[model samples]
Target: MSSNKLSAVLEKQIHHLCLKDFPCGYGTWRKTKDSTEGAETEDTDDLLDLLSCRHSPWRHDKSWSPQAPALRRLAVLTPERLHTDFIYNYFTTLRIVDKGVSVIDDGLLRFSKLEELVLSDNKITEIPAENLPSTLKILELRANRLSALNSLTNCLPPRLEYLSLGSNSLGSHDDIFHLTGRHWPQLVCLDLSDCEFKDQRALLSALSTLSCLRTLVLEGNPFTLAPSYPGFTVDSVPQLSCLDTSWISAEERQCFRGLAKNSDLIVDRASATVSVGRARGIPDPLMRVEENAPDFPVVNYGYFITYEFLSHQTVNLNFDRESKSDAANVIEDDADLQSNRNCEKESCKQLMVYTEETCHDVTHVSGHSTSKLTWSECMDFSHTHTYIVGDLGGLKRFFNKGLYLTIEEEKVLSWPAASEDVPLAKPSRPVKEKKSRKGEESPIKSGSTKDKSKDKKKKSVPELFQDAPIRRILGSVHIPLHSLVTGGQKVLVLCNVGALQTESEVEATQTLEKDLGKTIKEDKKKDKESKQGGGSSTKQKNTAASKGKVKGGQECKMDVHTDNSVSVQLEPVTVEFNVELEKWQSASEAHQLLLPQHNSLSKQPVLS
Candidate 1:
């Protein structure tokens, strides 16, 4: 309230408080003023001494009917007293309380440079935006008749930031936006503490759009009375860091987001982050490629055959004793091959090449090609991640090495043999032969074995491993089979993962050990016989030298016999891969045993 410029609306006489030439007030209504004292009235429509104009006080009240006398008086005195061009440039602020200023009439608009205007407890119904000065910033229109905010949308000063429209019926989202909208982009703080609104939803919906809002006061409003109101407000308006007097903290936001149910009155963040529309009825990758795709041409066909096929193709087909042409036709017709000449369609053959015992790279879809898979591209929808937890021994035995485990192996590995009380007995060592005092050798038995073998039935991929402590396996999840670009080329692969052992694995191991023991016994007998034979041969040679004598130029001769034998044992380890709806079949039977049976954390209502 600096008095740098005087604010006076005297009666018929001017005050002589200082020099008679002191500067005039905010509005120079009259050159002269009176010192007569008067009491204020209750009815605001009644005229007061706020202006020097001589307009009849009775004329201000439009409700007064039969206004013939008031109109007659206003026509004569207005020309001599009221003038619109007299700009009140001296005063920076003007405070007039209960002055009966029903409208933003000529008395206030004359202050073209007015910065601060407080028109409290008045009958001012509305102010047209074009009448106010742009230089005005702080506007206090509290306890006034201003109910609607529509008039103040652009009427306020362009630089006005802090506005107190409190205690007014200025409610509703439509009215609220008149102040919070683009017209008031620089408004960082707003005071609508007691303002009325349609509902909490309507209010929050309007406030959420103002991304620039930093502080808001809504304490006395009806919308702020709900349970978890602080949470709802903070979450509904992300930009609002402070509400009323309470400061919104990171911990509060984290806590209230889940606890508050009203926040989802609008699902904005979900709609913004992911496009759920794309995931609906999405086609599988394998379906896009035809099952009977023509093989791609190999430019260097002869080079491929010589290096890739001819060198590797050592197996001989035992065709029946028939014509050459017939045998050729029979070979081509055997394996459901499109054509025997088409070698490019060799992926199926290679699929069953690696067995459980022989693990290979899972990355390699072909000898020369790798699988194409990026996590983001493959996971088009929601996903659940699983962490594997089991013994290291279980995992080591689970996988052959680098290849994916076969279905049987995966089943055995997944099921725990720990269900059985008896442990698997260790293999016995072969008995060593006792050498005689004479140091004689024994004859060795020839065991039959064959190698150039045909592909046999695939053995179980999972191996029996010793029980160990829990080994946490992280990032283990079943990828939907359709997502793979290998065209549904999935195989039983061995992965060294700690997992439960099954009854099948235990039974299979017992059978294998029995077979292995018989083989070991036969090997021991062969070695013992071979040693005895060597010992007898040496003894005979010694006797021949001692009993027989030879003439002086005759060379001594002796026959030393040795038996040589070769054996090969071939094991079957190949299996057929079904290609019909392979993707759907794998997904339907995907692993679910490892998933947690109960998740209390997921059911929690708030973030800890």
Candidate 2:
């Protein structure tokens, strides 16, 4: 057939194939003209038979050869027939290529229209800089052996946004810095999280220049712990809005409090130990505000912290939508001020120190903000002799030795009316009923009334001493005496002999009693020696009688005389009691009372 006729037939077949569904097993055939001159000595019938043999309309076959001049305009080609001419013309917009094709050095230029080039998960490692089309926006070369980004220095498109070079053996930040400057100006995100960097300074310098960079994820890098490393400070890079430093898990929002001032950056131990204020080279901003004001607003009155919400017009502070209405209501409520005072008193009932049993509201007593530690204000008193706060279930776990006491408890214990000699009172007794007197009761009224009066006096004296408020009990088994001493708190351990049970308790009681007796006897001897060298037997007896006697296994009922009108009766274990004149007197007395006695019976025996 003529060249013009063959070209027309080829175009018709190509058009038909293009319209059909892709990868369809369809075939077409056409005849090619002989290139050699004077070779057509055969018959027309022979040429027709050859053409008929090459043609098959229904089945796919490679009859229309791409090398033929008639089929040169075809855009797509198979891997076996990928020629330079085919790539230059038809594959102009092609951005993706499958494996098994070794056409890397094609001489075509200007692939500026392509956006994404996904050559990832492939064996192609080295990319020639000049070969890459400038129009390429994304180059995904992840999971390949890319030692350095030097190859991409000249080829990196300015508009490249996302570059995933993950899982590659890219060594250091210096290796990747070759792709910096105008080459990657529009690049906003870079994932070099797990890439091994010998020094982060290169990365830091490179990142410092990426003014448009919004997010940076640096995790699993060894140089992250290196010293002299200035972290991602917000002040240093104003455009860096988000940074994942691996200090906390990604799931937590804004982990690690107290970032460097004037910068959103967090400083760990690897960084310089500089205070936020000092690092910023200014006094604390909050302190400056307070210094400007005449007086700092009072948060707590007495024992309770109260927030006074003035008129909404007075304060022009802005709050989030959720809290705005509530904030306004708080300011408008006039009764809240009065209720706050009442809350102060009522809230004291729930106040307690840490113990074995968990006290959830101890955080409240410790003065933590409510938003930080979310717990009910009410104290759980079900667990005996124990308190807890937050997740700590024991008092020992919660508090280190410190003088912690509720305002009310402190006031009651510090009363001046409490006496050391008077015994503590038991709880109040139930009321008694008066018996009705019938007709004969009037005859002997005076004698009966006198007898009743005497009985009442005897009963009242015991009741008064027995039912008095217990100022302090020293040797109660429920209370941990050793814990109090070892927990770093300075406390007075007062023991009463009456509370002793076992032989160990008795020995402990006797040891305390003998020490008290010895101290009293020594004082008396010193007094006698001071007054005169010699004293009469009667005078000695009188002096001995005047001085209080110290006894073992007996509870001393002392009336605690304090400044307050309410008198407390203190029942000390195993020894006579005396009022503490000075603050340190109690501690000194306890120390003296714990001294070992000489006699075996008076000495503290070994406890089983």
Candidate 3:
């Protein structure tokens, strides 16, 4: 379309020039159509077809039209004019990425020796199989506009070993059949990641035919969300050495074997494994020990995170309303429908009352449990807890409530050091001693000493970090569960922990805010004067006011002084963790139950 052509794009991309001699009679071939008769013939050795030639002893001169050696590889950039007559048959690899090429032209046939062709990130809808070189062994059409392989699969290259069609619009279950060994028998590695394939059983059945398929990727597809995924795929195609990004372990293969046989397998609830891998970014409480308590002698501290979430049984109540009420449940028939209703409408306002009551009841009876895990600053804590969800609707509702995480910080403090340096607790004399002196005046003094020793042991037990006297709540964050249930893929979440403020810190923050407000007002006044009169003097005054405001903000950082102590400024902490939801069943039990039912044929009575 544009004046810029593929030749120009190739000139800039080529790294070096290679020259070689052309085969004899390389350009002598010419088509000869008999005019008198209807027959046509091609002349392969004739040279008289040449219109012009230099003088030579021989009638045919070979030097006049020297055949230029063909390029073995070409990578073009932004090829406005893609097709050309000059692309030769010597090419083995050709790459044209993100060039907006929408069609595969016959010009590609010129590269008879082409083995690999990369046409990723294009606007291509269908790849005409005839346009591709039969010698092509690897083809990558990732991130294209292709939706179906009906056109391409009809005549796939017999030698095609690797094919990448990821990030395309190929969503049809019928398209899965095109990937079987019937099309490309030698296809060993296939990438259909980020595609739209949804039927898990159909996909597995189709891939099972590719006995040579060693590596398969189906991530970002709807079918991958099945609890049986990867395992089901592995079971269906045991020849696969790798699935998605993970290598298939022998133990995993052995565990999930035979689960996908006959394409009728359902996952068992108790066997599903939901794993949450290790986390990063969890702040170490010991890092701030020196700042929080500098005078204390050898303080012992430990940190752990606790997460609270609702079980699947509670959320299932929203969907299985028909089981509880004969009348169709009006309050939450559909999440999308309820979301579309306006809160300002009278009908919606009336519904809210019932919704709140239902939610409250659901919350009360819900299996709310808190699990504590030790924080790992150096590595990941790859531990996970499982929750059973019976159906898709229940799974959706479960995620709507999400998970809550709280970081609890504890410290073991020495009493003598705390009494002398920190004003947390005041020393008190024992009234028991006075009572004992009066009640047991005749008792031996040795017994009193022993009682005192037992009392001291009970007062300080450093091993019990959970019930430690000095406890600090670092922060808490909420993670939505909806993401965990989607795509059946593992995901890492990172959240910043905003530390809670103490009484003294809160007071100081309020003071700083007031000072900032005054400075802001002063800056506004200076800005107004500058806007009114655009002069050098006004500009200088504005700059000086801004500088003064900056200094004021710096000075506003004051120490939080309380009645008897100064509070330490808390730092922001960040935490990272991985979460994954798995179904113990061969496939999610919820999905299996949701399958459509068909009416059975009636049987006619027959004489025995």
TM-score of every prediction relative to native = 0.30, 0.28, 0.48
Q: Compared with the true structure, what per-residue lDDT tens digits does model 3 show for residues 88-150?
A: 554566677776667787766766877988888877888889888899998999998999999
| Residue lDDT tens for model 1, 475-517 | 1212122211112223332222223222323334455555555
Q: By TM-score, is 1 or 3 better?
A: 3
In Å, residue 182's CA in model 3 sits off its true spot by 2.7
Q: lDDT: which is higher, 2 or 3?
A: 3
Steric overlap count per candidate: 44, 42, 8
Model 1 root mean square deviation, Cα atoms: 34.1
Question: How does each model score on lDDT?
Answer: 0.37, 0.34, 0.54
- Output the number of the lDDT-best candidate: 3
Q: Tens digit of lDDT per residue, candidate 2, span 1-608?
A: 21122123334434553322222211222212543454434333442343235463422333332322222213112223434444333322232222322223423243334565555444455666666666666666666557777777756566778666755666565565664555678877666644555344455656667766766655434343322222333323445556543322332222212122312111111210100000001111121122233211211111111111111111112445575444321112222335543442223222211122322221222221011111122212111111111211122222222222111100011112344554432212211100112233332233466675775634322222122322222122221222321212223332222321222233445666676567667667766664584558756764565454432212221211121112112122221111111111122232332222113223433221
Candidate 1 local Cα displacement, residue 597, angstroms: 25
Segments in model 2 whose C-alpha atoms lie over 4 Å from true places: 1-104, 107-112, 224-236, 241-608
- Candidate 1, residue 364: the lDDT equals 11
TM-score of decoy 2: 0.28
Query: Where's the lowest-lDDT run of ten residues in candidate 2?
Result: 271-280
